[model samples]
Each structure stands twice: as C-alpha cells, then as structure tokens.
Target: MLQPKARKAASPSFTSDEKVKRSTFSLRLTKSKKEKHMSHDKTSLPNAGPSYKGQPASVAKEDGARRRARPQTEVPAVFRRSRDDYSRGEVKVSSFSSPVGSSVDHEEEEEDIYRDVDEIEREREWLVCGTGAAVSPGNTLSVAPEVDILDYCQVEWRGSTSSAKRMRKGYEAVSQRFISIRRVRGDNYCAVRATLFQALSQTLQLPDWLQNQDLMLLPEKLMAKCTWITEWQKLPAKAENWTEEMKACLLLLKRKWESISEKKTLAERQAACDALFRGEEEEYSLYEAVKFLMLNTAVQLYEDNQKGLEVPEFSWLLFARDTSSDPFQLMQNHLNPLGHTGGLEQVEMFLLAYALQHSIHVYRLYKHGTDEFLSLYPRLPEAGWPEVILITEDDRHYNIPVRMCEETSL
Candidate 1:
C-alpha cells in the first residue's frame, strides 16, 4: 500500500479498512429505504392517511395522527350578510358550503330544518278517526292552517214549549234554597206550605170533582186554596192538633167498625144507610152525617161480638183496638172486628189534598200518554237575563229563566 500510495482511487478502492467502511454505509442506506417504505405504507392506510408533505425530507413526519372520529360541521366563513347587523356569535365557514347571502334551494337543508322542528315539538299525532281522516279540526297543524275544534262540534236538538210560569216558580224556589243545605227546608212559613201542597197534590192525583170545588166555603182558611196553604202554616202546630171539639167531630170514625161486628145487639144500620141516601148534595153536613152512621153501627157491633159466623178472624185489633173509645173499643175488645179499607190509600189522599193547597208553581202534564210535555232550555242573551243556561233534552238554551225555591212537593 505504501508503494501504491500515489494510486488512491478517486471513488475509494476496496482496501481492508476502506472496504469495511463502505460496507457499513451500504447497510445504513438499505435500512433507511426500508423505513421510508414503512412510512409510505402507513400514510396509505385507510384511516391513518395523508402524511405531512411540506418539510425536510431527511426527517420523519412530526404531525400527530388523526384523533377525533366525529365529522366536523364547522360553521360557514363570516361573509357580508344583511342579517349580520342583527346576528350573534362567531361564524366559521370552514366546512359550510352555502354562501352567506345566497338563495340556495337544497332538499337536504329543507329536510334538516323540518327534522329539527319536529324534534322540538311536544304534541304530535297520527290520527285516523272520524271523516275518513281527511279533516283536521280537533287536531292541530303547525305549518299552514290550525284546525278549529269548534267547527267540528255537532249537537242537534230543538225546543217545543216555553213555560214561563214554571220557569218563574222554579227560579224563586231555587233561589230560596240556593244556599240551603237541607233537602227542602224553608224559613218562610208561606214558602214551606207552598212546597208541601205542591208535593201532596202530585201524590193524590186529584180528580176535578175535588180539585175544582170552591175553596172559600169554610169560614177559616183551608188548604184547598193554594194561597191559603201559606197562611195555614202560620198557625201554630198546637192549634192544628185535634181539640175536644175536633175529637167530637170525628166520632163517626170510631163507630165505623162497631156496626160490622155486633149487629143484633147494635142499632140498625138503616139510619146511617138512609143518611147516605139523603146527603147526595153535601147538605147534611160532615158532623151530622157521621153521627148518623155511628148510631146504626153501634148496635151491629154488639151483636157480632156474641156470634162468630163471618170469615176467619184477623188480629188487626191488637194494633188497632180501641174499646175504651167506644167505636174503636169494639175492634179492641173483639180481636176480629173489621177495619178501614186501607190506611195507605187514605193517607195518600190526605197528602194530595194538602199539596194542592200550596204550590204556586204547577205543571199540568197531559194524562194517558199525551204528547204534551214541558220543555226547559237555557235562557239566551236576547231573553233579557243574566248568564244562566239550562240545556235540556229539548235542546234549547236560555238564561236562568226560572229561579228555584224550597219545595215540599216537586
């Protein structure tokens, strides 16, 4: 090598020391190429793509790998817009495609707007009822027109008879009891009597024979007259109770059964029977007529007590016995004495008589299924009344035409 020192190759020869160095450099270059190929493959990956290209080639890429997975929806760039004068927040158009002021009709955008609005709404329905799902009232719409529920309502009816008296009386009665808790109690004596008679008359279902009679024949006020009822209630209950005179008046009541029992021992029933034949015109008087029946029946009862020839004995005498009272005493002494026709029937009649005397309000409904019916409707503003509406089957609306009152019978 010393002899050839002058012959050093320009590119360097394969000398022992030089060859080792050359081989090491070749190895390093090969390794570097392999690393470059790996980096290129990484950049070509489906996700980890796009290596930084604008940098020194000697150095490996320094940019970090993609991290966020979500699609970026950056706001549009701030462009000169008319709405800018009244806008808020920073606008970024990094990804926004539409121009700030441009009129771009996009189906995607329209769909998005509708979607957002639908998500925010609280009420939504898919109705398939009434009118074959064509109408929209009772169901609200947002975009164009709102369906009106009032338009779809249908309540069909009409009025027949307009009852003024009933309306007035009802209003008065209801007014009196508007604040009252009792089913039908009244502070006014007149009101109470009116109410009671109203109830009684309805119960009795009195025929015209009794109902049409003159009410003033009695010296004292009587229940037969509607107005008289109000006055009658004013009299103390003690005064109305039977007195000795009153008891005497009802004497025929005691003798009624006596004649049926002891016939032979008793006076003839002819006197009483004859009186009945005589008093066809209400002339003999209630007191005298009753007395005549008593005298005839008294003898009859005395005779029946000794003989038991009639039907099976009834024990009504235990509850209805009244031997001590003479006429009633016959039934009491004889456990099988005949009794009155029917207590319930008589009581009902009396109650009816009581009712006709009181009620100021009366409705004369037709008998035997007549079409005549009283219809009630709520009052209207045209009727010159306040806001009181009564809706009935007759389908008429009116103000509170009738005030309510405390009623004994309704």
Candidate 2:
C-alpha cells in the first residue's frame, strides 16, 4: 500500500501511415541539410564558382536561370539565403520565381546555413611558422603553390654586397630570368638541370673554358668565374674537424643566411683595433684558427680591441650584410651567390644584375673595374664611394665610387 513498483516503460505502437509520415519527415530533413550544405559551399558547388546556392560551380548558372523562372513559392528552402545574398556577394538573380512550399519549406535554408557553419567549426585548424602564413583545414582558401627550380641550378651564390637593395633587385631579376630560360615548374628540376646545361653550355658543359682561365682573370675579363661542376658535390670534411678550406667555405657561405636587422657600413661601424682570428703565441686553439680565418678572409672582420697587422683579404674590403627578400633562401638557392674575395662582392652583384636582366655577354666584364662595380649595387643614398681604383700600390679605403669622373673605376 505504501508504494507501487516502477512500471515498465510503455512502448507506443504506430499505424503504417504514422510510421510513413515520420520517415518522410526525417528523409526530407536529411536531404534538406545536404542540399543546404552543397548550396552554401561556393568551392564545391560547381557553377557557384561565381555564386549560387545548391548548384555545382559548373551548372550553377543554368540552375540559377531555371530558379529565376520558378515562382517564389516554388523556390526550394535550400536556396533562400543564397538567393537573398543576391544583392551582396553573389551575382544578382533578377526576376526570380516564387518560393515553393516544398516538404522542407523555407526553413531548410536556415538549416543549410547552420549545417555549413557546424562543419567549418568542427574541421578548422592552423599553425604558426613564426609570424608568417597559416594553413586552414577547409579547401576554401587557395594554397600558394611554391615555385622550385633546382635542375638548371646546380650552383649557389653566397655574398654580401655594398648595397642590399640593388642585390635584392638583382636576385629577383635573376630568379625570373632563370625560371623563364629553364622552363622550370612543378616537378621539373630534372629537366631544368638538363636544359640549363644545354642553354648555358659554356658554363656547365665547356670542358676547355676553365683550363685556360685564371680564377681572378675570369671575373675581370669574362664577367664570370669558369662555371664548372664543383669537384665534390658533397664536401669531404666533417663539422667536428672541418678543413681550413671547409671553414673558409662555411664562414664565406654564412652571409647567405637570413637575419632580423640591417647591417652598418664601415663608416657607421664602431671602430675596432682587434685581430679576431690570429691567436697569441701559446694560446693558439683550433677554434681561434677558425675564427681567425672567418674574420680575416670570409666575413672580413677585425677584432674590436687589437689589430695593426694587415690581413690582405680583409685590408680594404667592406663588411656587408645580406638581407635581400622574403624567404631569403631563394637567392642563395638560385643565383650564384658570393664572389670569393671580399673586394669582388660588388662586382659579383653587378654581374648578377646584368645576367638577371639579359643573357650574359662576356664583353661586359672587362670594360671597367671598381668604377663599374660601385654604380650598380644597392645602398643607402648617403654611403659615399670606395677609395679603390686601378692597379696601384696606393690602394686606400675611401668612399670614391667607381666613376669616370673620379678615376675610381679606371
């Protein structure tokens, strides 16, 4: 008498008609949702490439035309928002027909919108590569395809020039030129390498070119170093015990890396009297040896505290910073980057600039010297000229730009 036991949950049975109505209701709702999704997604919807809901980008226009012929009451619920958006993002659908009172009704349009929103929220993702671009999960945003051309380019350039801006311009011109000449695109580096050899046969395939040319004379007279296959494609030295030559190459190559700040010219640089590389009599270490080579030969740097001994390579050369473009790796990868000696940086840039703009002419290299080198590179307006001039014992470090008027180029 106190309490009735909990009764079993009642199972309500329905007649065939009620069952059929419920099934119909669910089927319409699902179809309405799918149509709503296909309509809103402009990418997947074919003719909607321009803009129309519920139509593939291909047939969207035709479907839209047919939609216009129907009455407002006849217009499906899946298309209302897109049709309404006619005044906005989509193309105007003028003189459209009446909305149709379908099984789903106009409410299906809202359902589709909500369906798309739900999918986007569920699938979205992104990543941070420093402060650069992000990758979204949806195919809605286009992927910026990268341009690669390594085939026609077996060589890499590495250097800092007198002017960074001119150097950057030079690289862009070079990249554009090479891309055209090699016909490199997609997965065509292999073809590029083959074509590069064919087009630049003198540089890549001429067996006799470097045999008679001096490394120094080529830059002076040929506007090029004998472009030959590097003896060891893979270097022989290891990092722990890199050869003096290897160390020379790496430090020389270091100027190719990207950095945050612009560099100062010799005039703006703090005065230094140090010998960065040469160690004292008893304390000579391998690290010091590497440092000495890097400072005096590669980067052309002297110590900040003590130095009167002249390092011939570093003697009158300016230490330049290489900061050319976004994804700074492009130039080093594609162009012949650095010239070996410090004094040749501007000359290399000048030659690279010419090559970037036109097919290389050997005669351009010989006509002038330092005077020609100064005229082409990138620089701040105020950084005067170089003190360098023709072959003489009195070579100095003054900013006398290579010019006909100044005799610096002579």
Candidate 3:
C-alpha cells in the first residue's frame, strides 16, 4: 500500500459554525459503528439462551404464585389493591391522555373541595349564630320553629334594698306554691311569644289548626272573624262621607285576603300578604285589619270573662283594657305587627293576654334602683293556675328558671 500520507494532526482551532458541523459528523459516525457492532454481536449469539417470549409468562406466573403464597384476609373492596394498579402519579398522567377521564377526575376533586367548604361553613354558622338551619335558599324567616325562650333572654336583677326586702318577703310567702319564672325576647312579638309559651306548656294537645299555623297570621285570622271593623263602622256618624279612595281600599283588602287564603303554600301566602302590605294604597288595610282584630278580640275576651262563659283557668282568651283608652281610635296608631318598635305596646300585650286566657300567669318584674325588685301579678288570679312565669326588664323579656327565685311577687 502506498505509504499513507502522514495524517495531519487534527486542528483544535476552527470557526464556531465549522466546529459545530465537525462535531455533529463525528457523533453520527461513532453511532453508526456502534450500531453495526451491536447487530453483528446479536446475530452471533446462541439461541440456547432464555427466550424472552417465555420470560414474560414465567415472570407473570411467579408474581401470581407469590401473591397466592401470602395469607389472604377479608378486606373491603374499596381498600383492596392489586400489584397491577398504577400509582396516583401514573394515573394522573394517564388521565391527561383521556379527555373524559380527565374531566371526571377534575369534577370529583371539585366536589370533594366543595363538600369540605360546606362542612366548614355549617360549623361556623352554628358557632356564630347559635341557630340550626338559620340559612336556607328560599325560606325568609331565620328563626327555628322550636326555640328555647331561655336560650335568648338575658337576666339582670337591679333594685333598692327596701324593694329587695319586699320582693324577698313576697317570694317567701309564695315559695310554697310558686313554680318558676320564664322570659322571652323583646321584639313586637315578645308578648305574643311569652303568652303562647305559657299556653302551649299547659295545654296537653295544641289545636290542630293552631299547631302548625304561623304566629304572624293570627291578626289576619282574627280579622276574618271580625269584619265589622271596616271604616264604615269606625268613621264618625257626621263624617260618614264615602270617599272613593276609602271604598277602593276596602274592596282591595277583601280581594287580597281571599287570594291569600286561597294560596296553597305558606310561603306563597306570606309573599302575597307582604306584597299587599308593601303597596302604598293597600298598606293601611293591613294596619286596619290588625287594629280591628286587636280591639274586637280584647273586647270579646273581656266580655266573655265578665259573663263567666268559660272558666278563667281554662279560657284561651283574656284581656284587661285600660280605663281611659278608646279601642277604635287606638287602632289608628301603632297597630303594625311588621313594625320593629311599635308592636310591643300595651295594646299588643293585652291582645296576647286575651288570646292566652287563663292558660298562663304573667309576672311583670321591675327594677328601679340598685337593690329594688318588684313583681307585677296578672290581673286575673284563680286557684290551680298554671306555673309558667315570664319576666320583663326595661321592656326586654325572657324566660328564667322557677327555682332561681331571688325576688318574687308583689
């Protein structure tokens, strides 16, 4: 062979582009040589070695044998797993390849997160408001149907020393027969709630019609029974000029009441009534209805009590009217059951007392100074009266334990 020309030593110095090209070519050449060698070696290998075909089967068999070798125990299907199961990371990657699977997984995760959030929110509401089922989508009232009056009322005893002594003496005298004191909330419905609590406690079975009835509808029901309270009856004989507006209001109220009574659902009825009360023209109708109900109901109860038509202890209607108040005129002002500050007037209290009749005794407690305590007894007192008592302080009312009688009756 002609002596190979002296191979020039490879030069290290080169342009950047040229250097890159040379390196690439060298890598390709080396890869090709290695592949050729590997192919030749594979071809020359003996066929007597272990066959890959049987190797997979043997491995699978061995795995099955190992699994069977272990003692089996009963485990819930949810907790059970096989060696073939993919890890969470692998499953996540696979989920990405399948659109439906990915969407389903995402939805499941979202549901889990929502469930956790709902649980946390429910706990927070219970702790903060102390109300169960306080929030609902369509229900308006936040109050629970069954509530413990004592849970909401706060008690503070304050009075003069002499008053306290007097209260103590009264308590000692009544201690032998006195039951306990109960309190209620101080809203317009306070009197109603207080009186009802006493009545319900005494009655072995509440009237089916009254049992599930909304307390707010009492005025409306009473209005239905007493229709003579319209403006015609209330207006002065000389001032009986029939205004078109007044006639229209009376007609509208009649139709509204009919619609309300026809509504099948409580929510529907409440919404209809609310709408009527909200209307500027019809708003007065609600006031008139409630006023007449209060006046007539009170008068009826008073008359009934006088006639002894029913026993005082079992009567469900009782009212003691003020000596100098005009019942019809009283209805013109402060007859709003929806009002926050207006409904707790003496008139409303009288109405509630009349409704409760002799079912319960109301004890009005007063605290004038540091150590003075006074208890005002109910107007009607009869033998074997129910033991329920409600206390009022600064117009705030609540139920208290009968056993904790510090200062009693006056």
The best candidate in terms of TM-score: 3
**Residues 1-410, model 3: lDDT tens digits:** 45533312221111112101111100000000111101010100111110001001111111110000122222221211221221111111111111111122232222122124454344225321211111223333312232222222211212344434433433333232233333232223344444433333333333332333343354344344433234222222222333333334334444554556566654454355444422132444433433344455554543454455553321221111111122222332223212222233322443544433332333233232222132212333333334344444323333333332222333
Worst 10 residues of 1 by lDDT: 23-32
lDDT of 3 at 162: 49
Report the CA-based lDDT of candidate 2 relative to the real structure: 0.20
Against the reference, the lDDT scores of all candidates come to 0.20, 0.20, 0.30
**Least accurate stretch of 10 residues (summed lDDT) in model 3?**
23-32
lDDT per residue (tens digit) for residues 42-116 in model 1: 101012111111111222212222222333222222212222211221222112122111232342232122123
Clashes of each: 42, 45, 16
Candidate 2 C-alpha lDDT tens digits along 156-273 = 1122332323333333322322231211111101111111112221121222211333322321221112122121112234344323433444333222111101223321111110
* Candidates 1 and 3 compared by lDDT, better number: 3
lDDT (C-alpha) at residue 203 in model 2: 21
Please give the lDDT score at residue 96 for candidate 2.
Answer: 17
- Cα deviation in Å at residue 235, candidate 1? 25
Q: Which stretches of model 2 miss by more than 4 angstroms?
A: 1-180, 183-200, 204-240, 244-410
